[model samples]
Target chain A: MSVDLRSAFFYSRKDIFKNIKIFIIITLSIILATANIIVINGLIDGMIEDLVDNTVESSVGHLNIYPDNNERFIEGIGIKEQRLATLKEVEAYSPRISATGVLSNKELSVSSTILALDPDKERKTTKLLEKLVRGAAVNPNDKNAILVSSRLAEDLKLDVGDEATLAFENGIIKVYNVKGIIRTGNLDFDSSTVIMPMDEAYRQLAIDNMASIILVKLSDKSMSEIYKPMIMQNLDVNNIRTWEEETEFVSNFANSWRSISSIISGVGLIAAAISVGIVIYINIIHKKRQIGIMKAIGTSNAFIFTVFLMEAAIFGVIGVFIGDSVGYLAIKYFEANPFLDAISQTWISARFEPQLFYIATIFSFGVTILAGVYPAIKASRVEIIKAIWGT
Target chain B: MEIIKTSNLKKSYMLGNVEVKALNGVDTSIEQGEFVAIMGPSGCGKSTFLNLTGMLDTPTSGEIYLEGKDVTNMNSNMRAEYRLKYMGFVFQFFNLFNELTVMENVMFPMMLNKRSNYKERAKELLNLVGLGDRLNHLPSELSGGQQQRVTIARSLANDPKILLADEPTGNLDTASSIEIIELFRKLNQEQGQTIVMVTHSPEIGGMTDRIIHFRDGTIEH
Candidate 1:
């Protein structure tokens, strides 16, 4: 009995090893599909993280506070002036005055969105200073010092120390030194945004203690949801949009990427399942007679199935490992490339994160094992008599 | 005393709307330590009879007793166990797994039975068959006669009470056939093994202690 079991194991092992070409092909297919899943998942994860980071740092807080007539800001001129006792309640708040205008230098002119901010207060609440790519932050004392996005600066052919005239509504023109160029990932922001001190912006727009919105940052992200209702009840606010609600465009874009990644991963998993099924089915067909001979010689169906399942599992493991490694390397390579920086400035923004690697590895391995089940079952159900007689 | 007995054994194959009766109401008996040759023309169900006796196939309607245990109604797994424990078969095609060495082939059945010291027993069998020096050779590397000797060693691996051969030398040349016959004769005479061999050759059949002629699925004499 021992001899029979030893021979069976030896034969099964030899059979598996002898079919190295099939093994390699199956492994490669699984690896390719797994790699695609991992890389796509990684990219989606990175994109979402980048979107959230940019949203939180550049514009939206975990929460937002505004006047009761804030809903009117979407269509027409909003609250011209308001006294917000925000310092006593929130962690930090930056008063913002924003409008669409045209920026011009000697050689070029472009339409841009202008933001007026209190530099000291904004610095305490936002990431504007850290995102500067070419110049210094806007001086709170210099009424004419303005910061422009990298794309806008490039379009107007303006650099640090250059003079640029900002033309606002009612023929108001403010000339300012190009204090800094910043790059945020949002294409809309990167191409057409300019920042100036709040007082200077109020003067340009002919406003008094007026602002477009008041941005708030809290100590805890979850606190936004809790504090939003209290702020609404205490203050005569028209609407309260959280950072999550404010960054709808970025959120939507990230959501779409997530959907696409899921679809791709789903398709990859299906293809893997089919590939494994077909390969194992073919293997069963090829070895039908051998299977019969083994059964006839007293080998059990369970044992035969186990051998095939082991082969499928081996394929899955090998493929998942190789694919995950390749996908990780690809993501890393893209993250570190200078071209990515250029692309981020021009199109979408990105950051290199290690967390994506772990997520990808887990997803790749999981999908591979899921894909192996059908093939393993089919292989196990091979009928001994029919297999022996080629039926 | 009879070691194997089958009563009213019947088998049929359905070949796409046509029922081909492979065996019909066959009754036979063989004693222990007896060398018997079953002889028949083509389509006489000689091979089918061997399959039933070896527990490789089930009868359509019959009762079979091996060592006085009724086994016709045994399930597949049980039949396999019985075959593994009490029977050994040599096929016409030499049905050796091509990848295994001669020693490994001989050791296969013994391993299945969980027999200890398989190498020692395998070597003894190989030496008994005069192929001890060729243990490491693969089936393809040996001549027809040598390959049949390996099959013989394999069949004897489980220490079965009865050995069944279905044209064991059918594919071999004249010298190989005679050599296999001589081996079978010696195994029966020296080791006192009960062997039932099916052969078409009258000359070889004549050498057995008893020759049962089969015709139309029934043993005549």
Candidate 2:
């Protein structure tokens, strides 16, 4: 009464119901825009997360202790292991010896990086054991057993218990039976890589108690930066790198993807705003005569303006609610059946970030309200004579 | 006692860069409970006079007084307030909100006035217009005469001191026009309702207590 909010809401409700088809169409457009934003953003977030997880969990541990400049390999492994074992922040550590080698199965010869590791230690430090797709994990005591990536195994025509001759860069040759084939979903790691017992590597590479790098898995992966200095303070290593530094390429890619996502979302939201604005403007135009009649009968301009604005708010709330529901369902579906990224060779699931939902809701609702302003003002400013007579 | 008065009321506007004087230096007054008709030809400023006196438009020059209070200089919001408190308007087209039922349409003005008893009051007014049984009917569902009755009921929603109608029966057939005129006469006689209506038909104009002839934006006695 007297153009209060309740009366305005009453008018808006009746008007919307009277034009239910138009209301549904406008609301559906808003829903499309909002869901588009959520799904696209979720996929990008999932891709970035998948890339980071594979880099940190499958290969590069949270912290890697590498040989400092001018040094070929890290010496004093026993002392380093003892110091690393003393730290509570370190979950597990594996010392690895790497040598470029050629593996041939008589018919095919492929260049590969032979990584020698302690099977038990590598299991605790990396996801290598869990990612094994064929045969059993290499046993630490079995000197003749080796592991090969699924891609390399395919190239060399090797399988479980199949012997392949490996010739190291130093010309040391030996034949080892493949114990396992692993697919970590990292194309580089799966393409040209082999795993063998450390003892076998020591004999083949002619190295004594030296490691190319020590991969240290932290209890909390995110604490790599903070714990890197703490581990360095305790150990004698001068070159400790955090996972972020080791995965700079992935971080750069993620940043680029984020920028692209923002641009697309910006365009989408603006389109949504324009669509809402045009619909509201048309509604006002159709109601121009009624508005003038109301004014002629002593209804205040504020009342007419409030009624239209309330109509827009109703559209926004309903549209955004349906949009959020649709987006949540889509994200859940994608989580169950992940998207396979061919370029990265990873299966990425949509990540449900509550912040994304909140942002989309606010933008859509706020934009709809803003879109209502001009039309509402125009309705309030209608000249009674011209509007009534259509002059 | 005089309830409405206009002195030297002149209203001019630009019609595509050419000046159109809708009302020019007119003077008139309606006594309380007076049933008056403004009789004029097409473009004779009868509607303009009604619109200006009803506070629906501003005058280019002159003064309008309602119950001895000068209201010519009031701003749009003030005019709307005064109009809500004291004036009611009916248009040639009936102008009833098609979305609202007859009961809701009658209740709208009272609601705008923030009257708590709008429902009962609207029912009473609709019953007076012989439309009590049609309260739940939309204006589109009703015949033209019935819709006009609803408009009249709505015009009385706030119980304003004066009702100004521009060609209230202009679109009605002869029988519907007589019925509307009879309803107006009944309202004037029974409730002492003040009415100023514009009608071009001499037959309709002859029924009012008085007729003020208008021609070319000026009133003729």
**Number of backbone collisions per candidate:** 13, 0
Error of 1 at A351 (Å): 10
Model 1 lDDT tens row, A1-391: 1223445456656555656787787777777777776667666666666667666877776666554562413222233112234434476767687788899998588988888888887887888667888878987777878889988988988889999998896588878889889887667788999988877876777676555677777777667778888766655565778887786777788788879888887787677767776877776667677666666666555556656666666667777878778877777765565234354542222343566555545665565555555654665566644554466
DockQ of candidate 2, scored on C-alphas against the true complex (2 decimals): 0.64
Candidate 2 lDDT by residue in tens digits, B35-54: 99999889989999999999
Give per-residue lDDT, candidate 2, residue A109: 96
Q: How good is the docking of model 1, as DockQ?
A: 0.41
TM-score of 1: 0.83
What value does the lDDT take at residue A98 in candidate 1?
74
DockQ of each: 0.41, 0.64
Cα lDDT for residue B127, candidate 2:
97
Location of the lowest summed lDDT over 10 successive residues in candidate 2 chain A: A1-10
- Residue A298, candidate 2: Cα error in Å is 1.8
Runs off by more than 4 Å, candidate 2: A1-3, A105-108, A336-347
